[model samples]
Target chain A: MSDPCIICVAITGSVPTKADNPAVPVTVEEQIESVHESFEAGATIAHCHVRDDEGRPTSDPERFARLKEGIEKHCPGMIIQFSTGGRSGAGKARGGMLPLRPDMASLSVGSNNFPTRVYENPPDLVDWLAAEMIRHDVKPEIEAFDLSHIFQAAAMVEDGRLKRPLHVQFVMGVKNAMPVDREVFDFYVRTLRRLMPDATWCGAGIGRHQRTLNEWSIAAGGHTRT
Target chain B: MSDPCIICVAITGSVPTKADNPAVPVTVEEQIESVHESFEAGATIAHCHVRDDEGRPTSDPERFARLKEGIEKHCPGMIIQFSTGGRSGAGKARGGMLPLRPDMASLSVGSNNFPTRVYENPPDLVDWLAAEMIRHDVKPEIEAFDLSHIFQAAAMVEDGRLKRPLHVQFVMGVKNAMPVDREVFDFYVRTLRRLMPDATWCGAGIGRHQRTLNEWSIAAGGHTRT
Candidate 1:
């Protein structure tokens, strides 16, 4: 039988808030409840981001510890993944929670233009984050914002900065970054497979393109994010 | 009859200096002489970057004006393209020479990592540079360090931020950025042709891979840089 499709649900992202969606969970209790709902809906992985007291994104390890504990207790057998995205924190603080050792973390391997600013993942920062993940035995979901990022990730693996059998996420439809295009999406898949045949990959699309990515990912026999 | 291949010579870049190579032109007179040599060798375009008295890269419009004047005087019928790269300056300073109205100006629509740091080209700065190029009637040669930059340039054209009939340069082999790969080179050509059929493109590889890019570009019927 073909490998079952893994549904990864991002319970709360760094960008969205209660204002954007009333159902966005802010507190640890709410986040646990949200993950439990997604768990019941057959999501095998919980992609998480923590919020501060004022509903702002932060790289606070304390809140992340509490959320991880809650998810572990409430959603049995579901993998927990923390976001090391630039929006949540700057520099080393982005990897502060890696010591807690979630099953996985998101890693951006290169810089690209975001909607408003440059989503900077400098070489040093990317090396530092990959080292932290390795030290804590965390698998990184390589976040490829553009095409070169895939090549960079493969280079990191070859150089021993990253490990074998990588998990990569092809992100698309951001305002100034890679937009959602079917041909490019197919090329991304082909390139990743060509570079690292053992790697597993997923597709993520921002805003309205999310459902479109889900359909494409499923049809292409890759994982999907919701 | 097939169109003759256009050879563009980057007379002096930001990183290299007399220390790295004694032949690198640092002064205005030396740069003009260098362009004259390339023009005699059948190069029709002179890609230029100016240096200060201390031999460091600068966005000084005065220096650019002198270089433009020298090239125009020495290499008749040659296209002069100024480098608006991030290494020479930051923010709006990168575009300070656009008003000098060189035949073409290099524009990077996205950001990527250089050897040691993030090559930051934020959105606002990109928009400002594009607008400045439009205001000065200077044609932009899109410097695509990564795949997304091609898409970004096409989007800018569709949105009227840039003029049509684009000239894009596929830059590879930069450390920490896009590396030289034949598969990627072919994809870059195919993607550009798909997105903008009227567009012309060239291949550029840093350091030792420059000759490789020249050969691949020639074989693929694209322009090349030296």
Candidate 2:
């Protein structure tokens, strides 16, 4: 009868456009406001991406600094989750955003098609981020779009880069990622459950799939951020 | 890789109205045509519901007789999946569909909510259907809309109505059912893995969730019928 546990809000995601919903923040002030709004709406974690001064998407660490400080100023103690999926093809610049490492940095486990481009998180790049996360003491959140990505991520763990009590996000129902049906969600979850037995995961899906995957998180007892 | 494991085509589902999409068949001829089209479009399984000679949903085994005859005439040897979820309710008439003894009859473990109705598949009805399916050698596709449904069906197994090699369907993102998200999918599969470790399951999602789930099915080595 009480409220469901673990609500995480994904703020300023890299892909969603202003046309999708006008409320998607594109500026430091908008980002700060959005984070606070999500927090007030019952979110404990805020997944973030940076935008240029012109309100365009950017991977610049300084923009992150302002957003981070702004959130701290307004919504203190809120968990900050930074996106490591810098501009699509600028794979080499991933390390550039590590300046304000914050509490968490997302690392896509494998490459897959996105609507406009491929979300390529190559093994070497994944390794680079894992090593860097360890170096900075930042928690790495494995952002998996499909089952193969989970398998690839597990290999990383077996190879010793990813560590215990692993934090994962099973992304579904995206055009270039995994499909967002319940069976697909169930298969991915079951496969991962067998592979990463004790690991903790949450769900993030695009558009309508988000709500569906969100429900899966609620019923499965997985970590879910509103 | 090769074509996906199973191409399940859902035609003439009970709740979706013709107004939702004109493609939804209303007449028996229209419904049969949809099923044949799904089969021709590379689907191996056709999840079906027989419409009245009028547009309303009906549970008459005679109505299904025409459906069966049409499929055999149009696309022979295709798997036919029937619904125990008759449009009205799960009464003796609904439970009575088993006289036809379909190759596969949907066995919803418990009940949940729909937009305007309560789908009640109480334990007594479930027990009756389980026994019938076993005696007739029919496959009971235990369709679960929530986590509790999964357990409710499991209780049948403990009570000896449902035997090994269970076939479950995790129905996702339906209102008053289990929510559609990755965690719920995982929890259902994981729990089922521990309970009916040897069984097979498919995920059926409404609308946009389908494409996303197909990818998960491929990775998990589970069947994916679109």
Candidate 3:
């Protein structure tokens, strides 16, 4: 219990916009300001996703570089974690910003259903992303949307596709994907520990289930993302 | 221990061909002969897949109808189950043969990574296939490639997208999909029972793990597919 809990703040995800919430930071400067505020509030990691001029999600590396620079300047020592999530782009575009070598990047090691479509992380794409992370010395924050993804991450680590001392995030409450079930959440923690004892994991819940995951994860001695 | 087991034989999958094994049946007559042999050897269920003239997998309803008729004549009383698997076709084409209405059709309720690509069974496609199966009076053998698929099937049954008294199949040993693990197999059985108390389930393991799943399933009081 004496160990510090790392608070990761996802300032703006790919889906939400000003229409959804006017407080959602879109521009690089706004994102930097928001992360600075979160950093001041004791958050140490800034999970980032950049948007285009029209405020649509994009994986443009130049925009990411600007965001990274702004964050590093505004919130010193804060972890910069870019999202390689499918929402931002398609195919190799998704990994275009990995070369920026932020402190870390969110990697989805397995595929699952999103609200409307299949969140496809094909095996090759996952391997390629892992390779990119390794080449760039960017630590991966494995996004486990389902039970098997935890196993998939363990396998990748075992096979050297991913490095050890893994950081995994259990995502729940997405429609058509894994729902926020306490029993399943507990199983995720137990399975991750069994698969990779040295691994540090976190839990993320979408929308109304967010508070529940944060509380459960905190109580269970795991990290939480807000 | 005294429950009679259902011996299901997958005569020809979409992957293996005559190049892989000369005994692999491609045409309707070949498939009929193969099923008849398996039927004589006590295979109560014949899991069928059809190939075009060039030996490529297809979801042609005419071919499926011919195969169904041939099996009905040759393997009398044996169950005919067609594969609505992704390898055979894309989208609704995967379920084209359902209208022919064999005894059953395999249905994947979720998406996951295959060795080379994403084995996509999108939410809408799964819903469509399940609806087709229901419309055609074709019982679906729910394919549980990953753990969440079991839950998805349970949810479908709960919502009447799929009828109750479910029959589910747990597929393992795919390259990038679920690996053959005894503990996972045991958990699958336990979870299925917990989710759908009246459900009957089976275990299918690929390649060298096939015998292991068959043995484990029989020893654990579930069905086995070869």
The estimated TM-scores of all candidates read 0.98, 0.50, 0.97
- Candidate 1's C-alpha runs over 4 A off are none
**Tens-place lDDT digits, model 1, residues A4-122:** 89999987889888888888898878999999999999999999999998888999999999999998998899999999999998999999999999999999999999999999998
Better of 2 and 3 by lDDT: 3
Misplaced by over 4 Å in model 2 are: A1-4, A17-20, A86-89, B1-226
- Give the per-residue lDDT digits (tens) of candidate 1, residues B140-198: 99999999999999999999999999999999999889999998999899999899998
Clashes of each: 0, 25, 0
lDDT of each: 0.94, 0.71, 0.91
Give the interface RMSD values of the models in order: 0.6, 19.1, 1.0
* Docking quality band of candidate 1, CAPRI definitions: high
Docking quality level of the chain pair in candidate 3: medium
**Please, what are the lDDT tens digits per residue for candidate 2 over residues A1-226?**
1334667888867766677778788888888998998888878888888876555677777888888899888888888888888462276576666667788888875554444443555556667888888788778788876545566667678878888667789877654234565765676677678778877788887767777778888887777755
Cα RMSD (angstroms) for every candidate in the order listed: 1.1, 16.5, 1.4
Best prediction by TM-score = 1
Worst 10 residues of 3 chain B by lDDT: B175-184
Give me the overall lDDT of model 1: 0.94
